[model samples]
Target: MADTASQLMLGSGLTVVSHPLMYVKMLVQVGHEPLPPTLGRNLFGRQVYQLPGLFAYAKHIISIDGKMGLFKGLTPRLCAGAVGTVVHGKVLQCYQNQNQLEELGSDQKENSSSLDHVIKETTQEMVARSAATLITHPFHVITLRCMVQFIGRETKYNGVFGSIVTIYKEEGVLGFFAGLIPRLLGDIISLWICNTVAYFINTYALENGAVSEMKSYSQAVTGFLASMLTYPFVLVSNLMAVNNCGLAGGSLPYAPAYTSWTDCWRQLSLEGNTTRGNSLFFRKVPAGKSYVYAQKRFY
Candidate 1:
């Protein structure tokens, strides 16, 4: 609990510091001097990069406590990046919807949505998009980190900071974003396929009165199906981010530490987890030991 407080403090403090930095960057782009990225600090960033130097450090800080600290920091950054992810997903879905409506010969000049279909589809799409976004946002960060290590020539130390630095040095901005095209392409498919499927499935369940309100059972099923359906994108995205060249593009730079999704899944799977399938409820099973069992289901 104390650690949670500290993590929160760290996150909140970083937020405060980052806001000013963002403002300053904006000012500089608007023709202001904007303070140099390196301010009055000891020596320079070379100390940050020096080999066999105490000054050099691992990209990620590991704690005896494990994921709590890292997750604390990631929560804020993940939320920021999600803004981009959602926009990308939504814009693609919009274009797709447009194309479908055109193919149906419902030119907006005559009639686009049949008013009722518009409202029904709109409601369904919004719910699926929201649910899908939550799962993707978290996994996106986890996978991105894995990619950094995969692409590395020398780990230097495990973590994102070192990897980011290496990427900047090697690829410049363009190279840093090498995998973006594939990701955007995947988004096109995810939005069109996943959204439409989820909407129809959920709509059927609701009309049949399968359950009250959206629940984890449905969400988990949706997440799994969407994940499996988009397996190709998942592979390509990881390849580009970690290897810089994916299967269709070039030979991958590194073999992923994980051989298969099932292998990675088992490694990450929490044993005795009743909550394995459910995201909202997880608690210790009432044994002598603390367990990962679902507060609602076994993990």
Candidate 2:
């Protein structure tokens, strides 16, 4: 009981610790929407490379108001974190109890193999996570909206209650569930990959005794691998969600509203291929880039 309580406390604390960093990440990821430079290039024969001026951008974001800006959308995140922790704990406890019952039952022991047991456990965890995600997804949307709501930026969403009300009025209930498909798919895949890799590493360490002091390093590496594998999907999903709200609030520079996931993919791919850069994302936006690339959509 004490150990369980300690684990819960640690998880809650870790969730809290992650918020400040998450806010910073959101700030950077959504803050800059580069416009194409005009008359400068024809280098690769297409528009590309719009720099946000890293030092200048940083300076702007770190000013007195900007420092506080780091915590812009923290309220809903903390609330969601608290609720999610409680739900996670309860779901885990339920699964543990069920497994214990299966272990104790003689007939069940004969019916299920180790593989079956593992599969069942994985399924249970995935379902639990999905449920929690659905319940808390609206909070996430609110968080993103609030985070991206800059001082001079035009946004209808304000405080938590105001945002909720605005979304309801403008977008209806479904607005809260924007990007549901990609978000769920990305989360499930990432969770599965992260846990599987972490499990293997942990088991190997326990068996071989090769890693002692480097456990934390090993875990960090595993986390990095998982994040890298899933980051593109997560990034796309977040942009989609942001765009959904943008559709409600009006035009946004980061991502215009996509009709569907396929449309989003098409737009991203076009940008990648048609743009002069080798990478999908351009650092500098040329003045003519938007007009040249986006003019077709106007029709």
Candidate 3:
């Protein structure tokens, strides 16, 4: 029972952690409609209307989630949201690159808060969206971890997770939560989605009593449905964290430029990872370097 609770809590925490990234996603989906002046490009090609610099921010955030550390409580997330948004917004305003074209009146159009407007709006939207899901993510993280661990520690099956633990003990610990933090945050944002949909189902179930009678099965079913509803966060969070070098966030060393949440979503939708060359993650090579080094190492 205690184990179950922890898995639930940890799972939920991961979901909570993942919520912030999803905000970028929502903005990416609707944001293109607003930006008539932004020019963007990706691995595919040049785009006239694209999500600005939000993808870089998302990569940074995702990298943070991939590692193992004590300092990553919540401060990094808040800081990232606050600063990354402004940086991304300004960077997104491509008209600045056309500064030589300033006399054409494209750059002088900002009379209000400037490009920062989008950042503020986006950040607040993130907070609101994240806040909405906070109520549930922690529980899920703990629950899932506890569940897997319970089986891992006690069971003797030939499961892949179990085998991985046997082969790469350290990697195994990390892999169990390969995308741990982001997964949690993703779960957090997912509450908004799952709750909105499940509340009705839950109410219906309560009134029915059929599922309720088989309490354990019912709980499992609930967990299953919730997990399914929440997998989008899980998928994206995994992508971000898996590439991280076990530093501030689970960020990959080599990440492609991204425009916004839409780019992030579209990216993981096809290829779910950036790169697996984690050696460059924690260490920075010197100018004339034969090897890389790190002040602190996590594996």
Candidate 4:
């Protein structure tokens, strides 16, 4: 219980600190750029039009909605983080207990190889992660809509209970799970990719006595690589969370009303935006693509 409380507090603190950057990233993900590009030198020392980076985007939001506005969806996000942590812990504990019972009942534990243990642990983590995501997804949906509300200056999703009522009234219960599938898929795929790559590299590639010490960090390295590969799914999921959900940001000019998450994925792929919002800094508009900014204020 103490450990869980510490983790919850730590997770909430990180969420609060990271919310502003995440706010900017989400706006980027939804293709909302109220700020115009400025001429800046690229890494090659050539002058190029660079889209507003994190600080610029954050300042733009502050100008429109004040400093506190940077935390528009923070409440729900905190709730989601806390709930996810607790759910994952409970579910993982259950899985561990079950495994212990099975080990007690069977003699196969002694015969189980290291790879088998790795796979089993990975599978348990995947299951716990999926459950946590599924259970807390409603909070995720609310948090996303609340953040995207910045684009349209909509207050439809204000507080946690209020947002719940609004979603049920406007979009029904299904509204709470708008982007669940892709989020779950991204998480599961990333977990498997991380574990599989880590296992292979640690097992076969790290036979050197001194160099083998790096095996401890293999999972972290592979997890980073996996996140990079699965980032498009995350982008698509965030987009779907707000797509055509009766917000100006979800409509024409800001975004096309995507038929579904897959349709959103297809459109993003065709436009070479599968990796959009992947970077918070050094954003350069694609050559031949130009942005037209309208002088508009929602406040």
Tell me, by TM-score, which candidate is best: 4
Whole-model lDDT, candidate 3? 0.38
Error of 4 at 194 (Å): 0.7
Better of 1 and 4 by TM-score: 4
Error of 3 at 96 (Å): 50
lDDT of all predictions: 0.39, 0.62, 0.38, 0.87
- Candidate 4 per-residue C-alpha lDDT over 78-100 given as tens digits, one digit per residue, 9 for 90 to 100: 99999999999999999889988
Candidate 2, which segments miss by more than 4 Å at Cα?
Answer: 1-17, 31-58, 64-66, 107-118, 198-220, 244-252, 273-299
Lowest lDDT block of 10, candidate 1: 49-58
Which parts of model 1 are misplaced by more than 4 Å? 1-165, 202-220, 244-253, 256-299
The residue-by-residue lDDT of candidate 2 on 183-220, one tens digit each, is 78878887777656655675565544655555567668
Local error of candidate 3 at 177, Å?
21
**TM-score attained by model 4:** 0.93
Q: Per-residue alpha-carbon lDDT of model 1 for 219-294, expressed as tens digits?
A: 5676676665654454444444443222211222123344443443343333332122122112112244322222
The TM-score between candidate 1 and the true structure equals 0.36
The per-residue C-alpha lDDT of model 4 at residue 158 equals: 84
> Scored by Cα lDDT, where does model 1 land?
0.39
